[model samples]
Target: MTRSHRYRSLLLAVSIAVPAALGTAQAADTVKLGLVAELSGAGAPAGTNWRDGAKLAVAEVNAAGGILGKKVEMPEYDTQTDPQVSRALVQKAIDEGVIAIIGTVYSGSTMVNMLVAKQNSIPQFVGSEAPAIVEKGNPFVYRTSSGAQKGVPALTPYFKDTLKAKKVGVAWVNNEFGKGGRNVFIAEMKKAGIDVVVDAASEQAQTDYAADVAKIKSANPDAVFVYMNQEESARFLIEAKKQALPMPLVGEVTLTEAKVIELAGNAADGAIAHVGVTATATEVPGIAAFAKSFEDTFKRKPTHDAIKGYVGVWATKYVTDKVGKVDGEAFAKTMHGLCLKAADHPKILLDTCWDDRGEMSRPSFMVQVKGGSPVVIGTVPAN
Candidate 1:
């Protein structure tokens, strides 16, 4: 080969090799995200929903060419619904250089892990709606689901005006989630001028609510507000129906889950609950397509937990992209006042990105179980 020709060939090779090396280096700089879930224990169903939902969103993000020139890497751990386990997992994620954390289906676990996130200043996006999660003054924490403070106000009016309920009986599990929810419900119901004649608090995960149901029946409430997990809630409903309590049953978001209906069977019929979204609501923005896509991917309809997680990932991506960096502080600064358009739908579920307190401000919906499915009653205004 001539000297000049050899020189040109070497230059071309150098140019190709430089870009190739840079590409490899860029690929190696992956953005790690931590997903803390309840992959075992009683919370597994909802936790798995959250995990799968976030995974689907991550898949979509990567398929669309990733973010900041690197693929997002989700390092996940199952907390088994244990707060201590969740706390350790949070530290592990932070130590492993994760920029942000998502999930922990149960409120208790989220609260525990979020404290660690606060100490480390790593942003935590939780799926729980307990009022206390955002009340801890942790700037690093944010939520996709509306909490009791937001849900109760919306629920109280529906009980009074929509359902025409006068005297309501209250049943809740005695835990952070149930107590916080009960306190808010009582305060709101009083404001609505509705009487809560029977206030019954049950032990967490108690199987037999026969005694509690009897007291509620003795009060003969026009409607009953129940705040419990799906298993206990279903057990209570089945027993309540067997005794023919006969009043309309109303509850928080958990009551709207398909699992509740499936567990409660015919007992779930005529029950009312507050829900953020319904996959069956075709009028909802992007719900039809989101449902279709989700069913195709998972071969089943997505739950409220799934949708919350999906939105959480997308919301995180929105802020990260807007800031041009995967940073917790930067995202937190702009998290409030930024309106998020959901990737799958235009239903405007998250009307306000987040309030000053880091609580998600979104419209609420009341759904009723008719033929064992959640049918939308109407929208509940935040104010």
Candidate 2:
């Protein structure tokens, strides 16, 4: 965000903060919800969408006369897209005595604060897709989106059964997001009896990826899966195009941001990306109405992070309703027991009406660049 935009957002946040405080003050039987996420930085695009989406929902819910008998009030924290900072914000939200807390968007960020949430017995709903995130099996914390394990297995079938690529190469940034993506993709590929040509590692902080691309080109794989965030993705795409690498490039959800389009320019044309089809609330009727309201209020499309942040709040609302209070034990009872399904929910990718311990049953699809816009190729599923 530019200096001017940051100031504007800060102003907007301050404005929202004042009303939230007043609203909380007026609460007799109202629910106080806190949304914590990176409201600024590179993650801001997605983060703000979540902040605004949750805000939109709270507004509507309050207009309809709140949950659990009183009006709903949301006090938000901007984690600035850093895991360390998100940890602090979690404690801050807890100290503020919020009934339930709604955010902490990224897998890495969510991972940082999971302990705080567990210790406090706070009900936290996250939108992170990293498999290791919930591996701790903290019953107090719930994810709305399927973990990377569940989401990426579908990509293997697309490669082996649909595209029929005999040999695939991987160029992934080394991190929870990238590492989990590769592990899941590799496991599925092996199960399908596919061969791996090049398994190269790339750093998310690197400025140039010419070396990685050259290595992949030398291996001459049929297709390449790039697991990287938008920043590294742009650099790789531009450099890959310049080097004229011919392999089809498939990507993880990290590349599905508007930042990729902005940074990669036309180089983004052929990069295929896999994302949760319904992470944002676009599919929700009430969420759709909230979306329009968000655009009217915030002047932008709610990115997946925004949807995730919004999901945290909405998830709390659902659980709180079931528990009839904001206690942690009660919330856990609802999360593990309540079969919440919202196709229109901001976190529908994590929403599983019927879930088990193995993997999620929701559909994950592969999308390709068509005429400069992304279009679904087919549903990528677990085989």
Candidate 3:
């Protein structure tokens, strides 16, 4: 070959190789996180809040210098409230090379999609409250809030000591989240010597609660436990008001959320719940600041789901920084038996801990809706 031809060939190789290496370096300089959520359909209220809260955390993390000196990039994937769709989106997120995932607030969807993250060795932070989400022993999966196994049992004392009721009615959505909570609540009720006189199961996105209300009213229980998603909880509350059931309405998680209160209006008043996290706990300076920032950015009140997403992302950053790099297996290892004190990490917003199975433990709240807002009536310490 001629000298000029040899030189041209060498130049071509250098031109191709240099940009390829730079591209690889550029990609490595940013931490990519997958945000999979039910951003549409039935779970939009919770999912959108979660997504927005995570986005807010991402913004703050970048502003304060991102994890391990790499900028954080989160790409969102909408699940459309379908379990199968959530699974697909999770797989897509993994394929796109996200080191960690924050996701589907719906427990049903999480149950189906979390496997994708597990198989990929990516740590996932979920907003799901289903006990089964963490019970299956997937070390890569973690909860942003306590599961039903913990949150529901916290209400047992309320029923036995505070409400002092012998008979209660249970109304729950027939999804993974609702069923897990219902089963735990039923067991707790039984242990408290309370009888479940009426058990009503509704579907996801169920619009009618007339028959459910009638059945509860006929059973004449002293109080009724409502375990459903946000929109469904509002619909049921409105129906209960229409029927004037005359029993104290109580719930966990969704019942007293801002979305439920806004949707149920006056019907949300007088309802009480045990919430794992609440944006209305203004007494906590960190939470108060988070709520204010969320409201300012989104132009709406933040829900517990929002708090979950916010803390989930901050927790991701906190743990990732502790790991000192973007290694999924290392991140998952660090999460088990991990505890973050709010005094040390203000972004975590609470003193939180996780067990070996990735279930979370934190101080929770018992809230009552009054004057169109959820008022924190009591605090439940972590067990």
Candidate 4:
């Protein structure tokens, strides 16, 4: 080949290959987000929901031209609902250089990952609402949603004043998630002058609550705080109906998820709990259009997970914008300092963005299962 022609070909290769390689090293569009959750086994349902929520947000960001022209990378890991597995998964993500992680869903799993993140100085955005998530003030961790201690307090007073239940009973899975809640609800109820008639624990993943239900029924509680997952929770409610045990039922935010209605059907009726922001697309600004797209794609309605995911994407946009460029530590620190207000939804444009102790400042609300669906009852303050 002629020297001139060969030189031209080599120049073209250099121009194309070098940029491509650098692009690999550099974060693009927004930033790379890593997630650790129980993507399989019993925890898969919640993990899948969490994954979908983040994806909903990512799609919107990409459509709007991404965060600082860098798109979000939502690569995730399956911790299989085991804390040790979650730790290993997060450590792996850190090695691969993910700037932040969205979830390690189960509280037990999150505790494991939280330690790993603290040790490595990696920022982990946990999906946990358990109070223990923030008690340590670990600089490297951020959690979305309120702590059980913070989130559940407002509801207790209501139960005594509004529901007028004299004796309260509590049942939960014997894990960090359940225990975190049992501790707060019991303390708050006692301080509220409500009698604690029943306190019980079940296996973390137990399917049957018949025996537990009978035991709880024996306590004669005027109301009961059920702190199990969606399926078990639904079963408890259904069994309550079957046994003709009559009382008002209350629970934490987990009770507001769509799964409760789907799993329990009419049995879920009359159940009451607090709701984090539930911004549907129409009421939200940029999100309305995005939610429309998700509904068309998924057929089923977009849920809390989808909204959480979208918020992560939107928050990343703010963080990346300030960073001026993408570096792991830089983006992470920016995220920690980020304060956002995204509520395009005209009716319920809930504001849920902040950097307070590395978590969002959500306006918590109360919802009741009126017709097998949650209906807003009251709003709670951030403090």
Per-candidate TM equals 0.89, 0.82, 0.96, 0.86
In the range 1-383, model 3's lDDT, one tens digit per residue, is 99999999999999999999998998889888899998999999999999999999999999989888889999999999999999999999999989899998999999999998999999999999998999898989999999999999999988888988999999999999999999999999888889999999999889989999999999999999999999999999999999998989999989999999999999999999999889899999999999999989999999998888988888988999899877888988899999999999998888999999999999999999999999999999997
Question: Residue-wise lDDT of candidate 1 within 46-146, one digit each (tens)?
Answer: 78888888888788768766656678888889998788998999899889888888887788888778888888878788888788998888887888788
What's the C-alpha lDDT at position 109 in model 4?
Answer: 86
lDDT of each: 0.81, 0.71, 0.93, 0.72
- Cα shift from native, residue 138, model 4 (Å): 1.4
Candidate 4 residues lying further than 4 Å off, grouped into runs, are: 1-30, 279-293, 327-338, 343-349, 353-356
lDDT of 4 at 154: 68
Model 4: residue 98 alpha-carbon error in angstroms: 1.5
RMSD of each: 5.9, 9.6, 1.8, 4.1
Model 4 TM = 0.86
User: Which of 3 and 4 is ahead in lDDT?
Assistant: 3
* Model 3 alpha-carbon drift over 4 Å, by segment: 1-19
Best by TM-score: 3
Lowest summed lDDT across 10 adjacent residues in model 1 is found at 343-352
Give one digit per residue, the lDDT tens place, for model 4 in 1-383. Answer: 99999999999999999999887767543466787777887677677777777776677667777666766677889888888888888888888777777787788888778877777766676767678777777766666666777777868767888889888899888888889999999999889999888888888667777888888889989888888766667777888777776777888876656776788888888888775654332433654665566678677665555565555545655566667765546756665655555534221235555454665666777778887667777777764
Clashes of 1: 1
Q: How does candidate 1 score on lDDT?
A: 0.81
2 or 4, which is superior by TM-score?
Answer: 4
